[model samples]
Target: MDPLYDRLARELRECIVTGVYGAGERLPGVRTLSRTRGVSVATVLAAYRRLEDDVLIEARPRSGYYVRNRPTKAIPAPARSAPAAQPSPVTGQELVLSLVKASNDPAVVQFGAAVPDPSFLPVRTVERALARAARQHRNRAAAYAFPPGLPELRRQIARRMSAYGCATGADDVVITNGCQEALVLALRAVTRPGDVVAIESPTFYGLLQALDSLQLEALEIPTDPVDGLSLEALQLALERWPVRACIATPNFSNPLGYCMSESRKRRLLTLLGARGVPLIEDDIYGDLGFGPRRPPPCLALSEGTGAEVLYCASFSKTLSPGLRVGWLVPGHHQARVEYLKYVLNMASPTVPQLALADVLHSGGYERHLRTVRSDYARAVGRMIEAVTRHFPAGTRITQPAGGFVVWVELAPQVDSLRLAQLARAEGVSIAPGPIFSATQKYRNFMRLSCACPWHSDVETALARLGTLTANLSIG
Candidate 1:
């Protein structure tokens, strides 16, 4: 039997989907809904919350809940990727740099950077926390914090990890500059230069940059657009190549934005455990899930199995990126990672850590997450709708379960690089797919960020991009 809240939510959702409740139409007040439906106010609220999480409705303080204007149609998600089955050198640094530069330009309509817009963030809350930290911990802020960061922050992280089933304590966490640094530490701790690392085909460009920096080769593995990394292909790659370590973003991967199932995560951990290979799991975007609960990390799945899953994550995606706060649990290799972190850079900034700790301790971070998650979910839906309306026939895209980026597979003749160049000239920035691959594949693919609010500017940019892609495809 379904819970009362679930039943209520389902009925309401059906009404909205069927157009019974028109877009922007206000829902009944909590008291009215409870009275009419013979349910408690809590149940009604829960139902409304579920709708908000689903990006179907929004709440306005002092007003009421209103149905969001969602697109009537959406594009079909792209098919599973079939990357080449050989190791390749990473060489997309220049292209990545250009994309980064263009993404940062204030004049451009940014669909390139996988960063949440400030409007969607808790800016005032963060500022208040920073000011309070500076005022209260002036001396601590003045000193350099070594390797393992603030005890309070680590405790907060560990406490949060328990929600995802990771039985970690403060001692297991090592703070770094960001998830990038944490990834570097994990990679350095596990493998040496010239070693081969297995990664998702349409992986994060940052991972490729890390591999390039360390002079490591990447063995591209086939990844599903919806299911995440393909275990069978990875197994084949493991059998064929002398892979040192496996790196993946199991929960809400960049570009692809697929979250591995719990069972698959367990299988992946077991596979790596049997091979004596460490799996570096990046969960930077794990908190941005639009579901009722956060997904479990691979480390959580590997718990008690003795699997060496180095869990890397950060508050950058959820909290404040400018703070550059990230942490990792390196399992058996904790000491080695700590030393590497010390050698790489004595420690992360003290003020930001303390400030973030205060924010987490205040119990406001969770509330902020709820708000941001809803915003991101809505933004992603809007982006999908825009693409469906604008893109030419045969264009395919990824309907991500979470995260703020969408991957689009254009016609074979369409060159995303040329499209990006054209988009930039028109004051728009986009991330070309070639940057996400080590072998420069995905030439007709592109990643679009849904981090910003929907507006005319974004709509215009997508239309322009569609036109450019159509022209390229025709030529």
Candidate 2:
């Protein structure tokens, strides 16, 4: 028994998903849809708005709505992860460095880094914004910005945060160099050296590196590829060890694209509050959700519950990463995080902050996001199809709901590091799974980037990767 609006929305969503309306094809006007479907104009409009919120449709001023390009075939998502449950010392720095160096080489087809292709970014729009910012505020651009960052940028971030269900004002937001610095400040705010922190198994390599640099112990928790962190496992770890803090990307996690359920988020917040531990949430990829609404973060659910969730995010994933503009909502630990940020580097670059602020204020950022979301979804779909066609029979992959990376698990006989080396020699780059874990598990796993548009070169590289995997398996 869905409501009238819900029913209408669902029906129309199915039509869009099933290609009843193809990409860039216009849908029936409000009046026409109302008459044809025997529903009120208001109902049709509501349904359209729901679709727009999901990034499934776009409304033109007088031209009606159009179908957004999205993945048609549903790739089966990866299964729940099972990593060693004990706390272990972080390693693999050399491997990470080597992989990063290789992934950055222009000679290779990059399926290793989790970065979006430059073509996917709004370069012209951003350049125009930057020029305007420099001309309008020459003095401001030249001066050094202090820790809390530009007021206009913070205000814009606060406005965007409300859309994601986190209620906060400009005064509560602290800008940093990027999400990386925000995460570092958050880690410093909550944990001491040698303290144990619980993290998702097969988590982002960058997080593992951060833990290693800060001399912290990692307790890997089993995580599902679709549902995100295993709350049951987290509770068990909390009971067994003296976990000082926890970090996770609850909405569209990196490597393994998954968003945690809202119910589970509430329960996790409650559990952390009861244990008097803080949770550092990385929401950099939250805006890329391919669904109707952005998944709410843990901080939104923990409001007024006395549970601390240090929220970190950036425009790098959705906008220009080169600008290095990001922010942190430090919950109750705002003062400490602000201080750490001040001591860490004084402040982020002023020119880029001003440029980004102008972009956000002019409403250009949102428009750009809509375009890229569609592009990324289409690219991911193509990657999934290519993988299915070329990989071995037992290959399993993650069909991410959002974000631009896919995790693939091959037969146990294939070693990812060796495969990575072979792929590198063939001018194809990939992120081996062993680097993602402190224990160097997932020897047969690798993460591939789906940020680039489909092209013959990418297709050829994927086929070669599959061949390399098969050859290694035989060896």
Candidate 3:
């Protein structure tokens, strides 16, 4: 399909979704639209067909296309999440453990964990790369890859990061077990026990676990469903508290999935830079954006501004999660993170680094991203549509631009934890909202994974989950 048609289709979709064309309203004739938009008849037809495939519009034998009645049109977006206004010690989540256990059971529909299905990853490509690396680095395969990891792997990471607009070198990159360790290292490098770290409300539960282990305090800020972290609330928090670091997933964050705009990123840097607080960027989901260009990290937008941005990312989402190769660009805290990486685990495994570097250098990684990005985008849409149609009329959900998870806000009367237990009894698993917070603020919301391939089993599971949710709302 021509890129032009895709752009036109997107514009037409915005129109239908925004109610420019009301339910069942007819759209302009193909030729008329083609002339008005200054495009060929083929382009118009292609655009209309795209919307048709998305169920946004439909065609009649003799009439022009018409907008389909949208189930989500009347439902407002999820209310912005508001965690505690004060910083407090992080706490463990038992529901997270239960969700993880259910996620591993094949009999259960897997919507608990926010990980992509293995089928959507570059399994074969990485396996081949691993074989080649083992054959080539037979001696080094048994060795420990000391701090900062292999120069070759670091260099590959540095080069890939350059495209994201960060000025990095092999010395600036530090490899860890995965993004989990990267976050722990970044937190330890900049913060101490009882120090405050401002974060998004309804954040990734893994982050809460990291803070809990480090004995750090969390200052949760209200986050918008569309624009991401609210700078106003963060600035206020910084003024009131002695925040040591601010951790954020500015690009396609988990659960919420809002990608902060470039302007917001710049302003955030200036705000934190003024206060001398480091911004620990968890960009694990940065590469999974549905847009044409990969979303740049906060470090990229902070260049020349003299802001402190510690960027962390991993190949686990795009490649094999078990491979466990993640790198961090610690702008000024590079030395601290390196030392901690050595102390925490001595060193990351040698062969996986070499294997990942091989896959990246071969140009297969980017090709793999192109396929998986589309798959995630399509899956997310299907999940949102399903929730919108079958769930309660007032149920709200995030419309993520990227990533494969959707955060749902159910009716206030419903207890999400109870809903999860009910769903589990029917062989369906879901991550209830309370698990996402250290303070456990969102009792009625839940985050659902859309990374699974859409099938009858998955469809049936979501519908059944919706029925259960409705049952709870009634009682």
RMSD to the hidden true structure, all candidates: 5.9, 8.1, 5.4
Best by TM-score: 1
lDDT (Cα, tens digit) per residue for candidate 2, span 232-257 = 99999999999999999998898898
Local error of candidate 2 at residue 315 (angstroms): 0.6
Per-residue lDDT for 235-332 in model 3, tens only? 99998999999999998898899999999999999999888899999999999999889888889888655679888889888898888999888877
The regions of model 3 sitting more than 4 angstroms off are 1-74
- Using TM-score as the yardstick, the better of models 1 and 3 is 1
Residue ranges of candidate 2 with Cα displaced over 4 Å: 1-16, 21-76
The sequence of per-residue lDDT tens digits that candidate 1 reaches over residues 1-475 is: 3469977987897798678999989999999999998999999999998787666789999998999876666677888888889888897668777777775678899999887788788888999999999999999999988988899999999999987799899999999999999999999999999999999988999999999999999999999988889999999999999999999998999989888999998888888888878899999999988787899988888865556889899988888888899999998798998899989889999999999999998888988886677668768877887788799988899988898999999999999999989999999999998999998889999999998766668888899999999999999
Q: Model 2 reaches what TM-score against the true structure?
A: 0.86
Evaluate model 3: give its lDDT: 0.87
Q: Over the full model, what C-alpha lDDT does candidate 1 score relative to the true structure?
A: 0.88
**How many steric overlaps are in each model, in order?**
0, 1, 0
